[model samples]
Target: MKIKQLKVRNFRLLDNMVLNIEEDITLIVGKNNTGKTSMFEAINIFVKTQEISFEDFSQSTYFIFNRLLRLINQVDFNSISERRKEIVEKVIQNQMPKVQLFIEVEYDVTNDSLINLSEFITDLDENRNDATILISYESNNSLSLLFSFLNREKQEISLIRWLKDNIKAFYQTKCFAVDKDSDFKKDIDLSFKSKIEKIVSFEDIKASRTLDDTKSDKNKTLATGFSHYYRERDQTKEDIKKLEETLTNVSIVLKGEYEKVLKDVISDLNNFGVSTPITIPQIEIDSEFNSESVIKNNIKYYYKHESINLPESYNGLGYSNLIFMVLELTSFIERFKNSSEEKKSEFLTILIEEPEAHMHPQMQQVFIKQITKKINKAREEGINIQLIITTHSSHIIAEAGIDLDKGFDRIRYFNKIDGRLEISDFNNFRHKESDKETFRFLKQYLNLHKCDIFFADKVIMVEGVTEKMLLPIMINNVANSLNNEYISILEVGGAYTQKFKELLHFIKVKTLIITDIDSVDGNGEECKTDFANAETCNSTLKDWIPKKNTIDELINCNEEEKFDTEFIRVAFQIAEHSNTYVGRSLEESIINKNLIFFKSEYTKDAINKKVKSLFTLINQHSSENLLIKTPWDLRPKSSSSKTNFSFDLMTFDEKETGLNWEVPLYIKEGLEWLAGICMVNISEK
Candidate 1:
């Protein structure tokens, strides 16, 4: 049996969120305040405490309460007509706010223990194997009392304040079994508490782990953990007898030492009037050894380094955290296995929050890799252990490979869209077999270079080494605000940028794809932008964005056509200098925009001689009578390296050379739009 999904309603920011669980491991990732922690808290509340506080209610729930209060305040029960009063009462009852957790479980009836799951299965169909258990925290027979209180306090106190103060008293937690096939619900009795525990065992290792280095702290090392484990673990009769016998001998020797140490105290006590003639008070010490107490207080865990032994705290936090998680996981699994057959849970879910805490990137990667192996081993032992990890670490995400059967299907992206939590299941991101090669390339690319896009606020997909090296500078010059935002700039060339279209759309991050026009002539031969019958061969421009063929149409395409979706826009080489000239690529586009800068003395000395001569020739001619139609064709073959040209530009400092250049017009416009959109999004939030 496994938890297929969890639906949380009216719980903090997770107003109506559904998390689809993977069979083994589910990785939840997102930016801050997107309800990753709140989701965990809701589950923790339901599984452990069942104590729902007023603060736990979502803002939407408060709105419901406010509307209900106004309805009650406006009505007059004494003077209202029966029909009107009935309508108002029904609305109030229906609109009462509640926080609910729905746990959907899937099982194979042939293999699973129906004796354990029978109470929660309401479905009558033999073919169906899914069931839902709804644990709801809602008002219990307190509607009338709540209405009366609201009416009495309507003038004196705020409704929100009143609700906050008295909500727990009126509300209670209830569990119901729901049929998967028919959506029918059956109320489980009070024994539902025990039944829920037997179905799933939930544990969490929160981000704020206690890793105190102080010797006085009880939970300072794995030795302390062992004490708790020893208490819970069953011991053999022979082992118990041996421990008791050794402890008894030690206690006897300790008693003799204690008597000698307290000799003066014994004499003083005897001198006092505390002793009677009939029964003289004995001044002897009695010492006893308790195994649990001795284990808990006396054992200390140490790390041996070379010839020296150090305490566990002596290790770095990264190592300490890794060790701590291993110990906790082992303990959880052992405890589950140690439980009696009747009480043991069918599945164990371990939710670890930010396991990358205090760890370096490589260590984080190794920890995830090793932990996954450990979880797989536990599953091999016939224990259904589902590991859910919430992380902000790209290293861990990258190390968790994106194979469909592995990490890719298990990743759940949590995004906050328009004041609501949205979950995107990567498992649902399907691809055609024809696109299998593209998917493989994308997987490798992300693993090697761009996994950070998962956590970025915005993405900029640029065309090759030149754009990758120069985009940061261009962004700083034009869209300075982007420097402060989490922006991931990926170098996926024009030919392949279209491959990321589906993924970018799925993530829904505001993205700007800066690519080239890659103009070609009728025979599919590379051509200048202004060549007759010139068309773009770039896949992104022709097939994905703008969807234009001719250079004239692409260059004249309106800004609105550039937007593929609300979150994605494309930009390419366009007309510059009042539509006089058009560049076919980024290198030509740069020279066209900064002709005078390239013609300057400093640029001539800084650039390759052959490139400088070509730029000088282009600058000397008029736009209409230029000998070379584009800088792309005029450049010497020896100076054809775009990377070297970019490097030359990097050497020219505006502060030192007193010369400045601008980013191409198309890129500037796209970046400004991206910045504007990000600002609008921030303001809306």
Candidate 2:
């Protein structure tokens, strides 16, 4: 059965969530602590209720959920004032921690007329529901986009069409699968126990009843002829030792004799100007060796074997996990109603949590490739493969390339910023995000494509869209005066400057930063000045730097609400401070006046019209798509603090233009002084 939709309410961290899930592979990812795990828990909780309780596996259900899953955010103590809010909301709104899931499984109707046309609303148990309705979105006005193969007609299509064409999905989780090994123990009951007990007896009875049981036939033959062989067999182990001694004797004689013959053969081949053959069938063993024996007389020519080392503790608790993915997959396998190619198309929803972990990078790729091959095999043999997995591995991410621009039908992105989840249909998305860094890297390094500087080489780092929209025009006029290359200046939803670390390695350049110091992390003072420095600072890699301040230091604003709102967080602080560093005037001009915006005059003629302008002064250049994502703390509509920022203002040009910055100024006097030192490297090649 295919899952059509999912609805979750006040279940742990998920607070009234609903998603329209497709039946095929669905991928989910987000930044840390942004409810990705909570969403999976909501799904597991619903599916898990139909199975056995946690006490059968762990000590208690709550213990597994709290200690194992760690679903609930632990508290030193929760006062009534805090906990009472939930109780009050229930009385007023009648809300409950209702974990609802909708799975629309499609099976062929042998008789279509038998379908209950009288509204299938009664399918769910109404007594348990707080409320129910189809979770449809208002923004899905592009009816043709949502459904497949429509001829401009918004009419409802057949179930056969939607099932065959439009089903999209994926299943993956992380962090919570640590205890998956024992999950199935809860589901094993009396019937499960009884089945196992009968298995041995049933196998023995079948073996005894069969006339052509193979072992019986072999036993009858052995009964008549085998006794005659035992006298030789009893003495053969000693024979093996004797043979080794003889083979050693023969080897010493052969080494002395064959040296002359082998030299003669090589001399003949070389004199004839001919290459020698690879295999020599007739080799001189020794005059002491017997050739006409049943086995090779020379024991040296036989087996030279060594034992392979294997891991001990085969059933140890490594692959055995808290989530029990393989065990859950067992249910999906058993749910197969038929083996027919068409009938068993939808059998299981496979959820994976970083299957790449504990595996080598090469092994991770191989494991995924092999499993996907298995999935494809299952699909052909009448089982639908629905995969949900998450990963920080770029090797894993490239498996599902963002071919959105190439008109591929499948793509989506889930980003976790602070405590919020931002999901978008990547197939329909158009934006410059940090993932583009990784995309640019892979395209060049992995795909071996030439870099397009508009997409790569040019590192654009600003705090928000405010700077993103404004800088290009300003750079066009001012950059050359200062010798800063007027590259594409864009914002990667940030103040997290460190995200650019890996990207710097790929493209071979450090990014220029532009940001406001945050309120907490950017706060100043030396050695024991900050709270993190009190204990955690000495324990971290960042200990060399005395203080890690909140970026609230850079902004010039005085308003406290600046921290709570977007667009204003950086610029608002700058405006209210009345201080002159990146002042309130420019801040108010961009934020309040809406003086900044990019209304895409986005034709290539418009983009490349300015694109060539960047090349007009360049000489040598190369670029790579590095898939390392520059993660950030500052996100749109988030109240979380912004930690850092970067401004990727310049880049190297290919020397074909005579604008290569790495060249010495003596030969290229036409180049301005500002064009010096922009290249990240100067190789001796």
Candidate 3:
């Protein structure tokens, strides 16, 4: 049964709170002292006492009062001469806080029905009112009919006979009832001697303990003896079964890691130097089970070696908090298999607290991957498990996208608004969650060059930040200070967009790409080039070039190859023609000084000179035309000249500059100009 809704009135830190739970795994996240745990306690009490009346849940009326007394911190009840007065004061003062629990459960009436055999017995209650509401055919539920109250009949009756035979209350809570003489606390304890007598397994185990009183004696008796062989065989079989169980669990965890959180988790791990090769060696999982089953209510556990050996409290609270996680999951799997189609229980709900404590950044991410993997696995298996977790893991929060509401069923946060427990759904476009700040910063500033002054309309996705920051400006100023039309220099987050841009483009977001002139492994880093400089580089047969940063160092190398490299030449040229330098060093101050020099008589001369310098030093030197063709919709770079270059930017203006101004820097006036008139398109029938 799925939880439709929950309400708590004066329960723990809760003061009349209600939450409508979604059918999917709903994560309940909040900080300390915010009533997250209290909600779970309310559910537990609600389920255990569902059949009882709301008034009977109070502390004053019956044996249920004992629980209330204990809650008031009263332990020993010894020398109290004023018992009745104290009890009255306690009852009036505490009063169990008046808890009312409501549950809406829909049962499958096609199979078994809830039979309250209690109703048939008439002698016990002459008043004949229903002490409980039990449904037979549940879909169209109606409260069971009641008269007044059941009273004992002077004559033998059906109630007496039935109570003597067929009914057994497996578990029950106490309630006050008016009786023939005095109120009674319904006694439910029964001796289990009959049932326990036939259970010989524990007795046999005890006997075996004696026969094996001395391990040495048992060993002697079993060695090369009939007993030894059988005992050894039993152990071998048990070990084999244990091994198989480990293998099965391994497959489950691995499938979750690889199939569910694959992309995100793998990418995060890459930052920690964990790659395919090292990952291969670490796949050996050391698992342990709670091999003991003393009361037969034993917990079956299988833990990873890293988790077991961890100084858990100190190192990874995320992993330790996860201990109960697998336990709850294993229990749910077992319960689902044994549940009747008609008698399903909502006990499958999982409540986790602070799944993000003390974990290293990478582990925080890894934990989310692991958890989502489990969620996916359960969903695929058709198990109706509702997961409610509280996390302090920022990585967990950040990785959850701002538009997470689309991907996730629901995402809510708990914070106090006017001194009350308040929750608000995300304002996705605002990107204000505690964890998404970095994501917004990167997606906004880093990916989309959002500077205040001198921003460009066109963006070129490049490999690194230095490339991202300097590429567009350098290209404009160095390539002849012309195409400064809202240029945005974007770092693709990586070389591969993972085909995510298919959506961005569908929205008509335009971007130019200037990759390593070598395919990346694919963080957008090109393979090492043999060329000494951009001049000698043959990027025609390669996908990457030396990074501009590395190129600067190479350009500054020993004067034996004295030459003005792109940066150097660009710096010196701008310096040569500037009125007042803008940078700290003359080298840096050059760019802002002279846009006129590059725009005028010197544009061709400067371009040809840089081109020759680039050609000379590239080991497999690429010609000028080839290098320029890639980032632009220009020539086939493999050709010898600029003969086939399309739309030469030698005279391209801001309007014709191939830049995207969708966000951060540019307004879309330039882009919408090409959308043509909307005059023809009409709303469809």
The top-ranked prediction according to TM-score is 1
**Global lDDT for candidate 2?**
0.32
Q: What TM-score fits each model?
A: 0.86, 0.33, 0.31
What lDDT is obtained when candidate 1 is compared to the true structure? 0.80
lDDT of 3 by residue, 17-75 (tens): 66655554455544445666666655554443233232222222233333443443353
Error (Å) of candidate 2 at residue 213 is 40
Show model 1 residue runs off by greater than 4 Å.
81-87, 141-149, 152-157, 180-183, 212-221, 224-232, 237-245, 266-297, 398-401, 404-407, 432-434, 523-525, 577-579, 601-641, 648-651, 677-685
Best-first order by lDDT: 1, 3, 2
Writing each residue's lDDT as its tens digit, candidate 2 over 1-685 gives: 3344444444443444444444455544433343445556545544433321211121121232223112112322245465664544333222111233333333333322212211222233323211122211111112222223233244586432432333222111111111112231121222322222121111000101111113223222121112222222323367656865776787688877777668787565545633555543443334454322313221111112357432221211222221123323333444342333333322356655545444455555555555556566666776555665544444444444323343211223343333334454433423225466544433444322211211221334455654554444334433444224434343544334333333333323223334433322223332211224222211111211112223223222232322212111112123212223221222222222211111111113334443332211221111121112111101222222111111211232223223312211111121221233332222221
RMSD versus native structure for model 3: 26.7
Which one wins by TM-score: 1 or 2?
A: 1
Indicate which candidate wins on lDDT: 1
**Model 1 Cα lDDT, one tens digit per residue, 17-84:** 99999888788987778999998999899878658889999998877887776777777789989998
